[model samples]
Target: MDFVKKLPRTSSGHDTIWVIVDRLTKSAYFMPMREDYKMDMLAILYLNEIVARHGVPISIISDRDSRFTSRFLAVNARGPELVQETTEKISQIKDGLKAARDRQKSDADKRRKPLEFSVVIFSAALHGWYYMVFVTTVGEEYDKVFNHFGYVKCTT
Candidate 1:
């Protein structure tokens, strides 16, 4: 959560030490780094020290900085076709039905659930139900779970 431009052992204008941390356990990785460290070198260090030594972790949290956000840094930079494939048709069918179901679920939780709205609610529920059944039937047809409710996919 903290970064300093200068360290006592290093020169005044040398590389920054990118600090990563696990807040719950208070463990940290002190990495002496320049932002411009090429992709290959960075991958080597990460695999050797972090992945190899410590093993895969459930999650890693980092600051919103260019070093983390750079397009070149992403391992899977999807091609335009793949990106379009995921967004345009693949996601829309799942998302649209989910939005309707969630609204119905919220409405149903109220003390005065509407009697006349039962047909509307049933149709919405069926859409959600069908999505799950289709995904399961198609053998994990979609990578994402239906009705994830704003869940963000972090593939790291």
Candidate 2:
């Protein structure tokens, strides 16, 4: 999640956009907001727009913005060791998700190979038909032009 700031203000005085992305699903949400929104306002917006719709995320990744750093530091101060352990677990989960996604992609590609091959064959056939028609048309035009110029076919 991140913020895109310093945008041109809208008519309703919004000059920033909150960008929330789900890494696993590759889904995203963009919410317009005023630049001066406080941390509490941000939390409320986050709850309403993200949490309310998708439920709570397992982990959030964001840039080291002051608000995020302050909030994160405050939360982790209670159990720094736990934070380290959680980070390791999150990394393992991310790796597993990556492997799963890769396997899914490979399976999908295997399933789609026949369809892709058929599409290529169909396109080649269509192009070949068009080329034949074009050559035929050009041959007819050449004959007409030669006949107009008084050229005759000679028989031996």
TM-score versus the correct structure, for each prediction: 0.29, 0.37
RMSD of 1: 23.4
Each model's number of backbone clashes? 0, 0
Tens-place lDDT per residue, model 2, 23-80, is: 7689999999998999999999999998898897555656655478668778778687
In order, candidate lDDTs are: 0.56, 0.71
Candidate 1 clash total?
A: 0
lDDT of 1 by residue, 1-156 (tens): 444445545554446676668675778887676655687977786677667866775544556644564555475576886688768876798898999999998787875533321111111333342211231232332335423544232223
**Top lDDT: which candidate number?**
2
Q: Model 2 off-target regions past 4 Å?
A: 57-156
Top candidate, metric TM-score = 2
Assess the local accuracy of residue 48 in candidate 1 as a C-alpha lDDT between 0 and 100. 75
